[model samples]
Target: MSAALLPPSLSSIFSSSSSASNPYPLHCVSPPFNLAASRPARSFLLGATASYSDPSDLSLVSPTSDLTVQALDQKLLTLLRQRKTEDAWIAYTNSPHLPSPTCLSRLVSQLSFQNTRSALTRAQSIVTRLRHERQLHRLDANCLGLLAAAATKAGHTSYATSIVKSMLRSGYLPHVKAWSAVVSGLASSGDDGPVEALRLFKAVTRRVRKFNDLQIVSNSRPDTVAFNAALNACANLGDSEKFLQVFDEMPQYGVEPDALTYNVMIKLCCKTDRKDLLVFVLERILELGIPLCMTTLHSLVSAYVGFGDLKTAEKLVQAMREQRTDLCKILRESGSEDLVENDESVFKKLLPNLTKQSDNEPPLLPKVYAPNSRLYTTLMKGYMQAGRVSDTVKMLEAMRRQDDRSSHPDHVSYTTVVSALVKAGAMDRARQILAEMTRIGVPPNLMTYNILFKGYCMQLQIDQARELLKEMVDDAGIQPDVVSYNILIDGCILVDDSAGALAFFNEMRAKGIAPTKISYTTLMKAFALSGQPKLAHRVFDEMLNDPRVKADRIAWNMLVEGYCRLGLVEEAKKIIEKMKENGLYPDVATYGSLANGIALARRPGEALLLWNEVKERCRVDKEGGKSDSSIAPPLKPDEGLLDTLADICVRAAFFKKALEIVACMEEHGIPPNKTKFTRIYVEMHSRMFTSKHASQARQDRRIERKRAAEAFKFWLGLPNSYYGSEWRLEPIDGYDSDSL
Candidate 1:
C-alpha cells in the first residue's frame, strides 16, 4: 500500500509514513508457499510452529534500551510530533536508558488509546502498573507512545486506554505530529478505532484550556493537524452530520480542509451505504462551493452502487462521458480506437489513472488511466471462469493486441486461467495453455506448478506431475512449496497410492519443505479412504499434538467417517469429540460417510438416528424423516449423490467404499447409470486383477474371489425380483462353501 493510501495510520506499516519501522510486520497468516525459485527453504521452517510457549510465541527483543529512554523519549516525542511513529519506534529502542520492563508496560497502555492501535499483552500489564503507581514518566512522551504502541501490537486494548488517560491527566497536550501517530495507530486497529480515537482527541481538545499541552511541549502555534485528526475520525465513523459539523468547525477554529481532508470525506461517501445520503452529500459539496474531482465522482458512483441505483450510476457515468468527450474524441481521431473499441472499457481503463497519481506528481491529479495487470487478467480470467476455452483464447489475443510481447500475464494471470481449466476437468487444454505460456517466454512460476499438479492429480496422471516437480527442482531450480506437495500428495491419495504419497513426503522433507495442515490432511484422507484407519489415526494424532502446524479438518473428518465405516462407533465418537476439542467442525461429506458407515455396521437403528442428527446439524434435509426416535435410515444415498460419492471413491480407488456406496444407492431406489456401471466394472477389475499391482494378486482363485465380490456388490444393488438380480457372476469352481 502507498503512504497516501493510509489516512496517517497505515503510512507507517508500508514504511512510507514519515519513517520506516517494522513494528508490526505483516505475517502471511497463511502458507507462504512458493513452489518456485523464490524463497529460501529455511524460512519455511522458521514460520512453522513447533510448540506454544507463551513468551517464546512472540518476539521479545527491543530495538532500544531503558536507561537512555529519556533521550529516546525526546527523539520519540519529536518523531511522534512529526507523525513519524515508524522512525520514532526505532529511536526509542536504540536507547541505552530504556524503560524498565514495567515502565515499558505502562507506556504501552498510553499508546493504545490512539485511533488505530492494536494492543500488546506485556505492554498492557506494565501500563496498568504504571497507572496504578502514578510514576508515569513525565519527560519522555516517546516512552509513553512506545508503551501504547507495544500494547496495540500485543492486542491488549483496555490497558492502552488507561495509559492514554494517564498521559492526559499529566498535563501533556499533544500537537498534530503526536496526535497523527495515535490517529494512524487507531485507524489500523479497526474502523471503530478511529471513531473512538476521535472522541479521545475531543476530550484532549477540551482539556487544552486547563492543560495547554501544545504550548508546554512545543514552540509553535496550533496547526490544522488536531482538526484533521477529528475530521479523519468523523470521516471513518461515516456520520455525515458529524463530519459536516467537524468541517464547519474547522474554519471557525482557523483550520482548512486540505486534499487529505476532502479525500477522507469523499471516501466516506464512496463507502456510503445510503444512496440518497451520498447524493445529498454530492449536492451539498457542490452547494458548499468545492469543485468536484474525479475522486469525488468515483465516490458518487460507488455510493450509487451501494444503494443498487444502477440508473443513477449510469447517469453519473454519462455525466463523466460528457466531461471527457473532448478527450474521447481526441483518442478516436488519434487512431487508438482499434486498441479499445468499447468506449465503456476505455473509460474503465482511465479510472485507475485518476486514482493512482504519483505522490510527488503535482497533486492536481489529472484524469489518469492506470490499468493494473489485474484488469486484463480479469478479462482473461472471466473467460476461463465461465469454462469458455475459445473465449479465453480470444482474451489472450486481446491482451497481445493491447500490450507488448515483453508484457504478458504473470503468475496470477496464468494461475487463474489454469486453475479454472483444471477444475473443469480439461487437462489437455490446461497443458496446452502451460505450453503456450512457456512458448511466449513467460516462464512458469510456482502457481503454474500448482495448477499443473492439481490437473494431473485429478486425471490420475501422478507420474506426469512428478516429472514436472523434478523439472521444477533440478531444471527450474525451484523448491516445492507446501501447497505444491499437498496437491500432488492429494492426487496420490485419491489414487489410493499411500506408498507413493509417503515417498513424496520424504522427498519433500529432504528438500527442507516441512509439511503443513494440508499435507497432514491429504495423508489422513489417503488413510481414511483406503480403509487404513490405523495410518489415519497416527497422522491425526501427530497433527493435533503439534500446535505449530494446523490440522486439516477435512482429513480429520474423513478419519471419523472411516472409523464409523468399520463399525467403530466408539472410536468415531472419540474422534468427533477430539475434533470439537480442537475447534474443528465436520463438513457434509464427512457426515454422509458416517451415516452410511452407521447403517452398514449392523446398526440400522443407530444409523437412522445419527443421520437425522447430522442432517439437522448440516441444515440439509436427509430424504424423509425417520420413524420411532428416527424412522428410516439415510443409508439410501441418492444416485446423484452416490455418483458423486462413487466418483470420489473411484478417483481414490476405494473399491470397498465405492461398492458400499453403490449398495446404498440401490437401497434408495436409484439405479446406476451407464457411466457409473462402467466405472464400477473397470475399477473393480483394476483393483482385483488389473492395473500396476495386478501381479501381486495371490492366485487365480483370488482373482475369481474378486470377481465374486464384484458380482455380489452388483446384484445386491439391483431389485430383488429383477431378472438375474441374484445371478452369481463369479466363477463358482474355486468357491469355498464357507465363503458363500
Candidate 2:
C-alpha cells in the first residue's frame, strides 16, 4: 500500500488540477511540465512521432499543447511498461497535456498488475478523474473494463458492478469480456454476490438479445464465459433446476459449453443427488469427444460415492491407475531404443545437439493425475456418511500410499475418521486412530482433543475427561478454551458432584477464560438440585456482578428454581420482579418450578395463578410473532410440562383444573395415569369431609405468611419502623427466620 513517489515539478502540475481539491491522495504521480512545454506542436500533429520529454522541461509549459500531451503519453506508457507506475501517473496527470484513452487504458492495466490495494485505489481515482473531472466521455471500453476489474480484485464487487452498469447507461455497451469478468468476480466472492452476478448476467443477455432483434451487430451478447458464470451462481445457490435451465439455453444463445461449463454442471448434479442428470452429462461429454480433466474425474467419483455406488468409483480409480501405468511403460520402452546406434548414417544427418546424449539421465516421464488430500477426504466423508466406517479407514491408508506428496493426510483427514468413530461410541477405536495420527507425524490439534473430551463426557467417565483435559493442556501445550472447561463443568454436575463443578468453574474464572451463560446455568442447576439453594443464589449474584457476562433467561430461571425448591416462594416471586425490571421475563420452566414448589407448600391458589400467567404469556408471544423487552420467547408445552402442571393442580386441590390438565395432556397425545387421578380425586373428597382440620391448616398458613411478610419488610431497611414491631423471629417452612 506504499504510495508512489513523484518528483516536485510533476507534483506542482497536479497541484493545479481541480482534482487536487479532492480529499483522497493519489497513488499515481503528476507529469513533468518541461516535457510537455519543450515538445514542438508539430511533433503531435499528423504523421509525426512524439518523443518522451526530459524532467528538466517539467516547469516550462502551460496546459494547452496537443504535442505536449502526446509526448507525455509516450513517456507515460514507457514508464508504465518499465513498471514505474508512479512516474507514469505523474506524467498522466500533470504534463500540461490531457492523456488519450489509449494511454489511460494502459496506465490502468499496469496499475492493476501491481495487485496492491494502493494500486487499485489509484486506478479507480484515475478513472473517476477521466470520466468526471476531465470530461472524457469517449474513453474506450478496455480502459473502463480494466478499472472495473481492478475494483473487483480489490474485493469491491459492488463498485465494480456500478462501474459496469454506469458504462452501459452511458451507451458504451461494454465488451462481453468486461461483463464476464465482473460476473465471475462477484460469483466467486463467497455467498455474498452470487445473486448480483446472476442479475448482471441477465441484464447483459437481454441487452444483447435486443441488439439481435434490430439486426444490429454488437459484441454485447453473453458468451460462454458469461453464461458459465451465471451457471456457477446457480450452483452456489443450490438451484439444480436453474442450473439445467441455464445449460439448456446455452445453445439458443449461441454460446458453446466448454470443459469448465461441464465441470460446474457435474458438480451441481452431484451436489443435488441428481445421478440421472450426471449420466446424461457424461454421455454428452463423450459424444463431443471432450477429454475429461482431473476435476471432471473428481466430480464423477464424488457423485458415485454419494450415490452409494462405491464399486463404480473404485473402477474409475482403477482405470486411471492402469492408464498411467500403460503410459509409463510405453514411454520407457520407446526411450530404450536409440536410432543412432541402429543406423550410423541417420545419426550423421541428425542435429549435432541431439547426436550425443548422456546415458545417466533418464527420459522424462509424463505426469499422472493422482488423488490429493481433498479428493481422498471427500471419499472418506462419503463412506462415513454411508455407514461404511471400514471403507473410510482403507481410503485413508490408500491416500498415505500415494506417490504424490499432496496425498498425505493432514489434520482434517485424520480428525474426520476419529470424529466418525467417536460418533459411533467407539472411543477406544477413535483413540487408536489418534495414536496412528501422531505416529505418522500428523500432530493432533486442539479440535482432536476436544472431540475426545466430548466422547469421554458422553460416556459418563468424568475422571477420564479430567485426564484428557490435563493431557491436552500439559502434553499438547494447547490452552483449553471456554468450551473445554464448560464440558467438564457440565460433566461434574451430571454426576451430582456440585463441589467439583464449583471448583472447575472457579478455576475457569481464575484462568481469565470468562464463564459463558451456560457455565453459570450449569453450576446453578447443580447447586439447586443438591439442595444448596444458598450457594445457587450466590452463583446467580456473582454472575450479575460480572460485567463481562450477561445473565440470560436460563440463568435467571435456575436461580428462581433454586429459591422455589427451598419453599421460599416469596423470594422466587421477587426474582421474577427483578427480571421484569431488567426487561426480562420468566419462561415455561420458571413457572413450572414455581408451581411445583407452591403445590408442595399447599398453596393451590398461588400455583394456579402462576400457571395461568404462563399459559397466557405463551399464547401472546406465539400470536404476536414478537417478544417485548428481553422477555424470553414462549416454548411449546411438552409432555413433561403438562404432567408437572397436572400434578400441581392435584396437590392444590383444584379438582376442576386438575381434570382440565388431564384433558389437555390427552389432547397432546400423552395418556394420563387414570389410576393416580382417581386416587387424588378420592383424597380430595376425604379432605373435603374433614372441615375442621382443613380450617386449622388454612389458619396456620395465614400465620406463616404474615410472619414471612413482616420479616421481609423489616429486612427491607425498616428495622426501627412501627411495622417492624409485628415481625417476630419465627422459622417459616424449613428455613430459619433470618434466612428469609
Candidate 3:
C-alpha cells in the first residue's frame, strides 16, 4: 500500500533510501539538497518543489520535481502511520506540495487526539494553512469535529467557535460533538459567554432546520446534550424566559429532556428567585416518569438553602436520610406545599406546573439516596450563612454519626465548621476545629486555613493571621495560595498598615505565587485606606501592566476610592471616565466613594450633577426605547451613599436638592434619617432670614433661600415658623434678662 501511494520514479528513490545495508544513504551523499539546512528552509524547499509538480500543468513539471514531492509525501505518510506526530508535522511542513486530503486529515486526527497544548496548536496551524490555501473544505467532517472538540477542551472556545463557523460557511454542517463543545465552552467561559452560547445554539438550530427542509442529512442538529448546554447557559444568566423557550423547543426538535435538563431547571428556579416552583419541577419530573438522580436532589436542596428556606432543605435531607421514597410527602410535611400550590401562576409559565394531583395520578416518588458529604456540607453552609454556628456544628456532628461512608464528614465538612465558627467570631473554636480535623486524620486544605486567616483578619488580629500563615507552610506543609495573600493584604488594610501589606505583596511575588486581580485590588485597598492615594494609583498601574490579571470593577473602584478619600474629586472623576472608557460603568461603590469625596470637597453643585447622572442611569423607560436598552441597568444606591449626598446638600443649604435626595431615599425603601437632618437644619440655619439685605437682588435671593428652608422644614415635619424672639426675652427665676 505504501509503494502504491508513491509515484513510480519516487518509489525507486524510496527503495534506495530504505536499503538496510546503507540505511544512512542521505547522510553519506548530500545529493541535491543541503542536509544541514534548517527544518523551515527544508519545508520551503519542499513546498517550492511541489508547486512545480501540479498535474494541471504537468508539461511544466520535470520528473525530478515529481520525485521530490512523492518522497516528501511518503515520508510524511510513514511518520503519521507510525503515530510519530512530531516528525509527521515536520515532514508535512517541509513538503512543497500539500499532502493528500486523506493524509492531511489523518495527521490532524492524530494531533487533535493527542490533546496537548503544543499538539493542538500544530493542528490549528494545519487547519489555518488549509483555510489560507482554500482547501479547508477538502478535510473530512470527523477531522474538523475532533479539532473543534480539542480546542474547546483546551479553553480556546472562541477558536473553536470560529472553526465551527468556518465549517458552516464552507457548506459543511458540523457534528453535534463539534458544535456542542463550542456551546458548552462559551457557556462556562463567564461574563457574556453564556449570552453568546445561547446565540450560537440558536444559530445552529436554525441552520439545521433549513438543511432539513432542503432534504439534506446533517448530524449537527442539537440533541439533548446541546439543549442542556443552552439551558445551563440560561440558568447561569438567570434567563428563565429564554430557558423555557429553549426547553419547549426540545420537543419540536424531537429531543427528550433528561435528568440534567430538569436539574438545570431547578438551578434556574433558584437563580430567578422562583423558589416556589421547586416542588412543581419535581412534580413535573415525576409526571414525565424521568428517573431521579442524586444531582437533581442536591440541586433542590441547594436552591432551597440559597433562598434561606432551610426548613425545606432540611426536610428533604431528613427524608432522604430516612430512605423515604415518597419525597412529595416530605414536601407536604415541610409545609411549603401550600406555598407551591398557591403559586400556580408561577408554575404555569414552565412545564406541567402540577399543583394538586388528580385522583388517579400516581404520586411523585424518588429513589432512596443516602445523604452524602456534599449535601450535609451544603446544609452546613446555609447555617454558616445564617450565622448559626451551633447549628452548623451540630450538622457536622450528624454527618459524622451517619452510617454510610459517603455521608461521613470529610475535609469540606470540617472546613464548613471552621468557617461557621470563624464567621461567628469564635476564632479559638475555629482553631480547635482545625486541631480536631488533624486528630481525625482529615487534613485541612488551603481553603480551611484561608478561612481562619480571614477570620483573624476580620477581627484585626493580623498577628494571629500571620502565625496561621507560617503554620500553614511549616506545620501542615501547605503553601499559601493567592487567596491567602489577599486575605493578609486586606487584613493590613483593616489596621491601616500599608507597609505591612506591601511586604506581604512582595513576599508573595518572591515565593513565585502570581497575584490575581483580587490580590492587586486588595493591596490597592490597603494603600487607599492608609490615605496614600499616590501609592494606590501606582499599584493600580502595576496591575494594568501585569498580563495575568485583568483589572475588574473592584480594582477600578478602589482607584476611584483612593482619589476620593483625599477629596481629590477631579482626579476621581477622571479615573471614572477612564473606567467607563474601559467598558465598565461606575456602579454603586463607585458613586458612593464619589459622593463622600464631593461632601469632603464641599462641592454641592457637583453633588447635584452626580445626582442627575445617577437618576439617569436608574431611570426606567416605560416606553421601551431602544436607547434605554443600551443604558446600563439602574444603580441601586445604598444608604451610605444617599446619606452622604443628602448631608452635603443639607449643609450647603441646597434645601430643594436635599428634598430630592430624601425623596429618592424613600423611593428606594431607605427611610431618611429625619432626626439627623432636623438637627443639621436647626444648627446651620437657625438664624436664616433674620436680616434683610439693602440690595434688592440680595434680598430676593435671601427670600428664595428662606422659602426653600421652610419647605425643607415642612418636609422634615418640623415647624416652618421662625425661631426669633417675639416674647422670649423674659428672665427665668434667677437669670438676668439683659445678659441673655
Model number with the top TM-score = 3
Q: Model 1, stretches more than 4 Å misplaced?
A: 1-372, 403-408, 414-440, 549-553, 577-590, 608-740
lDDT tens string, model 1, 577-684? 777666665555655666556545655445434534543442323435445432323333344445655554444444444555565566557775646655555555
RMSD to the native, candidate 3? 14.3
lDDT of 3: 0.75
Model 2 regions more than 4 Å off: 1-74, 77-83, 90-102, 128-138, 212-218, 306-312, 322-740
- What's the lDDT for residue 459 in model 1? 88
For model 3, the stretches where C-alpha displacement exceeds 4 angstroms are 1-172, 213-219, 333-337, 340-346, 353-367, 435-441, 461-492, 495-527, 530-556, 578-587, 612-638, 663-669, 674-701, 709-740
What is residue 596's positional error in candidate 3, in angstroms?
Answer: 1.8
Using lDDT as the measure, name the better of candidate 2 and candidate 3. 3
Q: Which ten residues in a row have the lowest lDDT in candidate 2?
A: 41-50
lDDT of all the models against the reference?
Answer: 0.52, 0.64, 0.75
The per-prediction tally of clashing pairs is: 54, 10, 3
Query: Under the 3 Å rule for N, CA and C atoms, how many clashes does model 1 have?
Result: 54
What are the models' TM-scores?
Answer: 0.44, 0.45, 0.73
Ranking by lDDT: 3, 2, 1
Better of 1 and 2 by lDDT: 2
| lDDT of model 1 at position 521 | 74
Decide which is better by TM-score, 2 or 3.
3
